[model samples]
Target: MAEQGSGGNVIAALCCVFFPGLGQLVQGRILAALVFAIVAFGGYALWFFIVPAIIGFIAHVWSILDAAKFRRLS
Candidate 1:
């Protein structure tokens, strides 16, 4: 996969801010997007506890950083 530029990545990361997996989807990482969406949303849905909330937060942060730093193939 081609890596996106820093600017693009920033935009992608911003997208992730709205939805955890959206960044990955914008970056062309469908699987990662799905995983993030499922894990975060599912965790929150399955258990309305602190643990799940924390996990979702972590996933959200990860998505942002990952998108910002993600490198794609030229």
Candidate 2:
């Protein structure tokens, strides 16, 4: 796995705070990035209904943490 606590990881985490999947993209996790973007945005689009909106919030936070913790395989 890639070494942890790099400056890039911090930047990626920050990116995720603004957009869920952006951090994953920064970390080279293309597939995960696409999935996170779709799910997070999709959930937000449904936010008008209220219930499922919570999923969006959850996904947002999850993405941030996931990006911060992600490690690339060597």
Candidate 3:
């Protein structure tokens, strides 16, 4: 994943995939931005299948969070 200033947002991205809100919550996005994850998943859940939406969220959250944690060390 791409690293950010430090720790990146890897955790957030990971959480997004499985629990979208988790990563944003971790990044301290004021709970509002996370709403997008829900709306996004909810909106397209039917088209992509609820489970996949969850997976997608997880991937995004993970990538972000991972990048964060990894960047710090880098």
Candidate 4:
């Protein structure tokens, strides 16, 4: 992937807007993608409760930020 704030990062972040961890998957981070998907979707599954919903929201936002800020080690 490109550096932070690059076009690729921008696209990745945008992808996250639709689904948490989708950006990570685009960025080639399989583990992170799975983890984010599980956490965010899992929390969302329990939306009946307020706390889980909030946690899901936070995870969704965090995934977007993480994708946007990701920098490959050189």
Candidate with the greatest lDDT versus the true structure: 4
At residue 33, what lDDT does model 1 achieve? Answer: 96
| Candidates in descending lDDT order | 4, 2, 1, 3
Which 10-residue window in model 2 sums to the lowest lDDT?
Answer: 1-10
Cα-based TM-score, every candidate: 0.83, 0.89, 0.43, 0.96
Best by TM-score: 4
Clashes of each: 6, 0, 25, 0
Return the clash pairs for model 2, or none.
none
Q: RMSD in angstroms, all models?
A: 2.3, 1.6, 6.5, 0.7
Tens-place lDDT per residue, model 1, 1-74, is: 34556778988999998998898998889999999888878766756678887888788788888888899755
For residue 22, model 3's alpha carbon misses the true position, in angstroms, by: 1.8
How well is each residue in 32-69 modelled by candidate 2, as lDDT tens digits?
A: 89988888898899989886688888888899888888
Cα error, candidate 4, residue 67 (Å): 0.6
- Which scores better on TM-score, 2 or 4? 4
lDDT of 4 at 3: 94
Worst 10 residues of 3 by lDDT: 65-74
lDDT of each: 0.83, 0.86, 0.54, 0.93
Candidate 4 wrong stretches, greater than 4 Å: none
Q: Model 1 RMSD to the real structure?
A: 2.3
Q: Give the TM-score of candidate 1.
A: 0.83
lDDT string for model 3 (1-74, tens) is: 34564333655565656654566566656554466565556645655566766665654555454434643233
